[model samples]
Target: MDQISGVQQYHQLFGTKVYDADTAFEFLTIAVFQAGMSWKVAASKIPVFKQVFANFDYHKIAMFDEPDLEAIESNSNMIQNGRKIRSVLQNAKAAVQLEPEFNNLADYFWSFKPDKSEEGDRDTIGAVVAKDMKKRGFEFVGPTTMGLLLVGMGIIERRPNA
Candidate 1:
């Protein structure tokens, strides 16, 4: 109602708000869900995900047992694909491992921002980052997905003032 696209609506909520690690996790969770689907579907499910995943705190989600994931699996409000739901925990766990290396999960994710020159070829940057994420034990982080995530984060955006 307020914007042209679901993604634009998403940006209206978050574009100017710089998030900490917890919120970054939430965004990434939705980003993963957005893969192979419309932004509308993924955006609609965010509130549900925030409630289910303890506001995307890596400390909490990383500790999620089978029962927790199962609960999400059974939640009718969610997109409910078992793999994506399960990956929330897996990805949280991976993010936890990166916290010590960087200041937090957000810093680690932000560190992969493609250089301005490299922005024109996001697929290449995404491939590189995706490989590293896979090496770090994250799931559902394919190159195309990573590229889209960068776009969502505004890290790969075209310069506005230019």
Candidate 2:
């Protein structure tokens, strides 16, 4: 599929949904894996990720021990990046911690949504969220990744470059 259609499909699949913490963590994981790769390539690996990562269940993922990490590392179907793989585990733990502060991961993420009149580019907005997430111990969440996440979540629209 072309980029536009691929993005449209992604938005249809992810953007329009109401996220609970599990779903929110799932999409955040997607954004992490999508970094430095095309959406098509990243999207293709999602099914396997879901299977290996216990359907993006943060609580389950938080419990993933070294054996689980080894299984994921040994899985030929996975992305195979050690750091990114570890980050998923780390982020899961971080997401679990968010429950007490914000009620849920979804609420914490959604609280960053900017108003329509906000005057900043996607990177600018994403940086704000990224900074906060880093403070809370989330990994693999740089500005660009978070920008894509925001767009994917439909918290912010993807705008054409000026």
Candidate 3:
């Protein structure tokens, strides 16, 4: 896909304006998969992921067992990292678990939105969120990951001109 369409596809897929479950799962799964890969490569695989992973439905993904994980791990079309795949599964569980604490992932994520719109924050909130996430049994999440998630969640906007 071209750059424009890629951005559009990603925005539509991950809910650029909406903070619903579909968007949340897409953000987490895509972010985790993009850990060490180029965004181009990861973005290109979005279709395959959607088809194979049941459109990133966290509730369904949370129910995936070891066999399901192994099958996905061996699939050449996917990122093929056992750890990341497991994070996908575990994070789904975390998503399910977080439903009660917050209305939804959007509510939880937006709670960390910076006070100043023009100014961006990462260090403090990222660290706190990452620490809490780890404590909640979420894996593959670090300060860096949390920072990126915040950006994806539109909690913090990246200044392209900066």
Best of the two (1, 2) by lDDT: 2
Worst 10 residues of 1 by lDDT: 1-10
Number of backbone-clashing residue pairs for each candidate, in the order shown: 0, 0, 0
Model 3 Cα shift for residue 154 (angstroms): 1.1
Cα lDDT of model 2 by residue, 66-159, tens digit: 9999999999989889889999999999999987889888888888888878735778888999999999999989998887777767677767
Best by lDDT: 2
Best by TM-score: 2
Global Cα lDDT for candidate 2: 0.81
lDDT of 3 by residue, 1-162 (tens): 334544457765442444777676777777778788775566667776776677888888889998988888888878777888888889889988987888876677787777884346665677877898889888877788687777767677754662
Which structure is stronger by TM-score: 1 or 2? 2
Computed on alpha carbons, the lDDT of every model, listed in order, comes to: 0.77, 0.81, 0.74
- Measured against the true structure, the TM-scores of the candidates, in listed sequence, are 0.85, 0.87, 0.84
lDDT per residue as tens, model 1, 139-162: 988898777666656666633442
